[model samples]
Target: MLRIGSGAGFSGDRLEPAVELAEKGKLDYLVLECLAERTIALAQKRKKSDAAMGYDPLLEKRIRSLLPVLKQNNVRLITNMGAANPLGGAKKIIEIADELGLHVKVAAVTGDDVLPYILKKCDSLEFKPRLSENVSILSANAYMGASTIVPAIETGADVIITGRVADPSLFLAPMIHHFGWSTSDYELMGKGTVIGHLLECGGQLTGGFFADPGKKDVGGLAHLGFPLAEVQPDGSALLTKLPGTGGALTLRTVKEQLLYEVMDPSSYITPDVIADFTTVSLREDGNDRIVVTGGSGKERPSELKVSIGYDAGFLGEGEITYAGENAVGRAELAGAVIQERLQDCYEELTVDYIGITSAHRGSFSYEGIPYEVRLRVAGKTYEREKAKRIGEEVEALYTNGPAGGGGARKYLNEVIGIVSAMVPMDIVEAELQVMEVKPNGA
Candidate 1:
């Protein structure tokens, strides 16, 4: 059996859980599934500024913290924390490993950037909003597959980093590398894909996202542990977490995670295969352990999905807290004042009294008057100056608009929106570049 642990679920996840996995989990591979749909687009923007700054900002810290333990425990790491710059990330890893005098092999799998391919066929794309001349494209990346990382594994790399690979591919790659699972083996492919889907969100499987006050109570949330999967050659997995770690790994959390972000339960599509999640079966094996099986897959898709990032505009936001006597009224009145003054500044405005009605936008109200309320105003505009006004107007509330209003803050940010297009599998190529430290020393 092969043991794989998830270190992080998203780009900004906490670091300690990953370190815990490395030092204590006793695993074959630990994957930091940090990249998200919008994450790489932002990384691309950062890359345009500093070539070496595009990868995960925490890449250095993570690699530094994990190197000694991972090397000592002989646990390999596979992660998409490379974001927009896998080669840069790999180089950074080598530098860190050398500083610690640890000998290890690192490989970067690249070629997910498909900007040129998209630009060549933009006019002919079947998707809507077809490459408008006015739209400024920031980044275009094709989601890579598990097969891409297999070559890196074959090179005996201790750490493998990649950019724009699918989340499941990070976990699935190690499986493919260890089990010798052929890409054409649909049954095993489907089974392994489900394992990735379940464990990709590190803490969710361990009850971080499943906690409720009393309804679905999870114990010891303060030190919630990440999850790991034990896989057999038959493609079945036993999912669990470390002992004495806070958080429950139960069937409830597993079911919720299984259905998370899955629109079509039977037809979950990925670069490597089209897995049928509906075919999956889950059974409780013991406390904090579940046996998963029955996931099946069809052949791969003809076209790989591409995430297209384009400059949307600037988003400006401001917030102020209102307390005591008719706080909701004061908050509403303050929002009205900003609304009347800035009608023509932005295309649209979102005004919310956060504690009272942010969720439904005042469509429904919670019970009883709250003692305190917060007024928030946000809008997006094509002009940065206009966007800046959103924060300015809210800051003005401190002196001009409402009584008892305090703790005002404002922010202005660049906004990048993501759209989807399709690229054929043949057009995108995945290659591995290896950087190694010798067995004797760096």
Candidate 2:
């Protein structure tokens, strides 16, 4: 059996839970799945501003927290913290190891960035209609798979950094490298992919995101521990978490996370293999332990999904609080005033009264009016200055329109929109490079 633990579910996950896993989970690999669909686009924008600023913002902190424990426990680490720049991320890891006076081998998998290829073959690629001829593309990256990571693992690297890849592929790569699973073994690949998906979210499988107050109560939430998977040679796994952690491990939580973000259980596609979740079965082995089995898959996809990001203009937002007897009415009036003032200034605008219609958008019924409400006005425009006016006009409403308006706040942000496309596998190649670090004084 191989034990792989999830260090993080996203870029900003808590560091303590990961530290617990490294020091106590007795893990073979600690994977930190950090990147998301929009994160890479944001990283690309930051990389444009500064050359060495594209990786996960907390990458250094995470490494600093886990390095000593990982080395002490002989646990390897894998992560998609590279974001837009894998080489830069690898170098940062090397520098951190040197500062800590620890010798470690770091590997970076690159070549996922396909912006140049997209530009050269823009008219030829199969993309969504939103990516029209006029749309200005900021970044284009093809989702790579586990194949590129095999060599990195073979190089005996203590840490592996990757760019955008299928979330499950990060976990599957280690299984393949350790167990020597054949690439064509779709059933085994599917089983491994299921383990990856279950562990990818870190705490989701262990009840971090499953609490529903009194209906579905979970304990120790403040110190919730991340999850780990004890996988077998056949790709089946026993899912559990560190003892005394804050969350529960049950079939209900596992089932909920299994279906998360999945459109069709029969045909879940990825860069590595097409997993079939419908065939999977789970059994409760013991307390906080569920034995997962029966996952299957088909051949890998011929064309990889490409995430393309473009400048989607600017977003300006402003909010003002209202209280007293007729707070709802006062909030409505405030929203209307902002709408009437900026009628023709924005391409799109929205007015929502928080604590009432903002969440459900009129889906749920509210019996009584609340004592306080926040009126929020937002607008979208191509020009930053025009967007700024949306907030400025709302700020003016404190003295100009509503009687009890207070706590007014406003800001403008540049929006980076994402679009998806299909690129042939042959066009995008994955490359791996290794770097070894020596003690700074040595």
Candidate 3:
């Protein structure tokens, strides 16, 4: 059985502990996914200016700590934290591994950082904006497949680094090479793809963010444990965790991960899967162990997927607390008062009394009276500098108006507005396809 661990958010520094856990548990593969909407923006900015400087410190630091364990255990990793500088990132990792006298082979799966290329392609393709759309492509990342990483593993690398790839590909890459799973084998591909989906979110199945629906104690979420998947030759996988780990690995957790983002189970497309989610079954086999099997996958669609970000515009928000016998009522009045004062300053303004609302779990539920309330105001302005200046003025209202016993004023910080525009899927498609060439030295 090949043991694997996966996670949602990955930072260079946060990856250190997870690496230790993988080594301590003697797992086969460690996968970290760090790409998010904001991450994409940061990557795009870096790529345009200094391509090499965009390397995330989190990826390098984590790999540095894990290298010794990986060298000892012969563990191979696939991570997408290589935002826009996988090659530069890989070189840094190689330097660290060499200094430690560890013979680590590091290969970077490139060609996925295609923001510049995609924009040029869009100009020639005559792509149009559909929904009052504007092309502010803040970040452009390619959602590649397992083919990119497979070549890296074949280089005998202890760890493989990659740019943005489909989340499931992280789990699928190791399974394909480990079990000699063929690409065209739809039935087995489905099996492998499903396994990746189960373990990709690390602690989701291991009781971190998600827990059993009906069970309260199931959220034993003090120190969230990472998730693991054990794969077999037939593409079936055993979903479990490190020994003595604290979390519930039941059908509920597995089902939650399975049904996640799955609009249609039958048409689930992975490079390996030709079957549907309906073809699979899961059962609680043992303590913190769930066995999953049976799935078929279909061929992937033609258009290569792209994660492109554009300008979203600017926004500003401010908050203040109100405390009194009738805090809820006072808070509402304060919200109205703040809006009235700011109406002449901003073109758009929104105010909400959070304490009495669903926010904070309705904690201040009072019988016709309450202790405290949170007043919040949010809006957008074409001038970000002006918006920030406006956010600074809100706290003054507390001392000037009926702000509930004039509780100490709380001012919100300057808010910077970022506009994210979604380009057409084709707007970010690859122009120069990635061809896997054999390593020069290996």
* Top TM-score hit: 2
What tens-digit string does per-residue lDDT give for candidate 2 at 1-442? 8999998999888889999999999999999999988889899988989998899999999999999899999999999999999888999999999889999999999989999998888887777745756778898998998888878898999999999999999999999999999888998989999999988998988888899999998888888888899999989999999998889899999999999889989988988889999999999988899999999999998999999988888999999999998988888988888888899777779888899888888789758878899988888888999999988988998789878899989999998888889988998888989999887666
TM-score for predicted model 3 compared with the true structure: 0.84
| Model 3 RMSD, rounded to 1 decimal | 4.8
Best by lDDT: 2
Q: What TM-score, over all chains together, does every model reach?
A: 0.97, 0.98, 0.84
**lDDT score, candidate 3:** 0.66
User: Alpha carbon lDDT of residue 276, candidate 2?
Assistant: 98
Which digits, one per residue and each the tens of the lDDT, describe model 1 over residues 312-374? 889999999998999989999999999999987677999989888888867877578989999
Alpha-carbon RMSD to native, per candidate: 1.4, 1.2, 4.8
Q: By lDDT, highest first, what's the ranking? A: 2, 1, 3
Identify the superior model by lDDT, candidate 1 or candidate 3.
Answer: 1
* Stronger candidate by TM-score (1 vs 3): 1
Off by over 4 Å in 1: 128-132, 439-442
**Superposed Cα RMSD, model 2:** 1.2
lDDT, each prediction: 0.90, 0.91, 0.66
